[model samples]
Target: MEFSGKLFIFLLLPLLQISTCDAYANPIYHACSKNFTSDNLIQDSINKTLSSLLAKTSLDSFGISSFGDGFFTIFGLSQCRGNLTVDQCAPCITKATEEIRTLCPNSAETRIWYDHCFLHYGTTKFFGEPDTSFTRVFSSGLIAADPIKFNYELMDLVYRMNAMTVGIDEKFSMYATHVSKNLSIFATAQCTRDLEELACRQCLDKLSEIFSGSCKYHLDCYVLSSSCVLRYAVSEFLNLPVSLSPLVFAAGFLAAGINSNLTGGHGFLPRSKADVMLNQLPEKSGSPENRELTAGHLSTWPVIGGLNHFVLVKFISGGLTAG
Candidate 1:
């Protein structure tokens, strides 16, 4: 018994350490999976899981695969920095997906995003709005070496981007731009179209509270979340086309918040006509996919690129309000 206990701790300690340290080690990723364990004899679980995974996988760009039989669909995706070639995107996503899964196998659902790819899954209860569940928090981990300069720049950039982000859809939305700085400091904002602009704004407002004193500008740090993703990479995070005068892939048409319609509740609000013209589009880059804020309704996702010493109000519990 004593030997077993000792061995268990010896093994568990390293695993815990790895989980804490390995999270921010990557730069890009994509992750998606279904609910329920991969091996459930239950017929219903098998059917639903397979269907959801197939719906996404067979969908052109997301042509992923399931590991188990028709019942289980184990899938993960990623994109390289738009500047990177398809070859680079492959490795970035592959490595991140494998590593993230190893880190949180018990999570059922986990998404570890990086500058290169995104890895996600749906094994546990990650569907719908986690409100506090799928939300993400980021910090600088360092007190602005110069508080005054940091505060001035950070606040200015955040507000400027926010102001520019209003009214327009993601196509023209500009979140933050870092000029004459070490890194291009190009940051952008994205919100799932389902949330009313106000609701989306509120989510960002709450996320701001997590910054506490960390939002000090002047550094390479930013907050990114599902409902709203914000970044300040000190570099041009958005990439231009690789081919000659080729097209750019904007995040996609953001739904102009849902209006009850001119008929008081009859007609639908105007969305990206692109939503209707899916067939016309060739690639999956700008398809109308998902538009939910959090995975389970209120929770947040794990965060990357932040200062070491920071605090997060249990997901959505904090009295943070941009609303």
Candidate 2:
């Protein structure tokens, strides 16, 4: 018994050390643009831009700023996950800023993504446009027990949530959740606040295509782009509130004449013009707001670039599984 205990301790020690290392290494990925400069003026502008972004970390979870002029100008921005509290967001952004400085010290343009936030600085203007080029897909690597049934259900939930996210009348109506058959899925699809509703919807549609094409079998997955992000997980990774009400709201819109053809060709039933007009009638006073902010307070500043993160936790029940 003493020898068996000693062997067990030796085996478990390395796993504990790995977990501790992962906890402290939060950055998902980072990129430094091919553009480089030895000019001191450009470096000064980059420094000032990053400093300004770090200074406003407490005021809002998302913000953008520019420093310097002409060829030496730098545009910088930072955005935290919508569900994070201000207290959580500040430190996440601060850490991201420090990481980018260390990782891309001499690059004139750089972006870094972490579990809870993203930081970016560049010489070109990149606001209001959807950037699907730079993307990362993270998966749990554990296939579902019943891939066909699981994929169908997961896709259906994600499609419904996508519809609800775009139709609501909020500055950032980009989050939704659903629960079915002992499985609960939380999803969020968001774009920079500067985007129009149609533009945001289009960006999310592209993300859905990437997810369906590549990550359909994984239990939890995330698709992160430069301009938008889509994430779904069995575990409750987001700090936002979850209400089972969005399903009903989306159904009502479907019953109306709203277009059923979303970007990725997933949609609800279409209705007649008369039904749509009737649904548009004004409601009585004291009606609930058209939108709900499940996440923390909305950020007033415009966001430039963003990404999403996924954390996998495994379990076993006569077989290997994860959620």
Candidate 3:
């Protein structure tokens, strides 16, 4: 028994270390502009702008700045999730800066989203502006056994979170609720610190409309907009530790079968009419309209991008797998 315990400790130590170090390593999505820059001066400006943004991560979770002058100037922004501490947030931003530079070496603009942080840079000044132009949405394809009740509880939780954002300094909030005897929902809503409260609310409301209309029945879904993000899952995905009551713990065991079935794969649904039209329009054309009609709801995929291209990822997994 002593020997077995020693061996288990040796094996488990490395795995725990790896998980802790790489908790925020995987990026959810990245967007690169089709436009490329061959000019060395512009490239150098972008490099400096990103480096500055990375340095700012040491002080605060949010940073936005413009570097250089004239046509060669570059603008950049980097932000870690509001809940993260400086130690947690800085590494994510550092990883993002490195990955984005490698992924879009010559693109004039880029945006990368990770579970804990996001980075965006461009030639144009977008510091305080709210841009909902690009969005990447992920859905856990698992359907709830009680779709109507689950959705109702989810909307209530999300709306309550939204309200929390209004008074918070960081424009971020999280909320959770037990949706059923055997299931619970955890959710978060956040806007980039640069956005005004009203702008944040509008951006989230737009994304919430998508959730209510299309992703209503999903067991988990997260929508990331250029200006704000909203996410919910059947399992807790936040970095914060949660202590469950005895009743909640019992419910989790009862939902074992549903969680087991969630260990599946992913598939891309057909694009929505809004996405199709957005693709056809000039990059500057109108945003997606709120078309929440009652029929064919499954076909109503939300517009995922405006100026740049984005992927719509649907994950069918055993738990909240947004990372």
Q: Score every model by TM-score.
A: 0.44, 0.66, 0.68
lDDT of 3 by residue, 1-323 (tens): 00011101011112212243565677777878746548888888888998899898758988987777898899998898766677778889989999987888888788898888889888888866767767656776678998889888887667656755543456766555677667777677888888877777788888888789657788878777778888877766653223332110001111221122211122111233223422333322221231122112324424322201112322222222221
lDDT of 3: 0.62
lDDT of 2 by residue, 60-167 (tens): 778888888998899877777654556667787878877887888788778777666778788877776766767767666667777777788677756655664555
Model 1 regions lying over 4 Å from their true place:
1-101, 117-146, 163-185, 192-194, 239-323
Model 2 lDDT vs. the true structure? 0.55
| lDDT per residue (tens digit) for residues 149-176 in model 1 | 6555555555544433333343123333
Say what the RMSD of model 2 is. 13.3
On lDDT, the leading prediction is 3
lDDT at residue 31 of model 1 (Cα atoms): 34
Q: Sort by TM-score, best first: what order?
A: 3, 2, 1
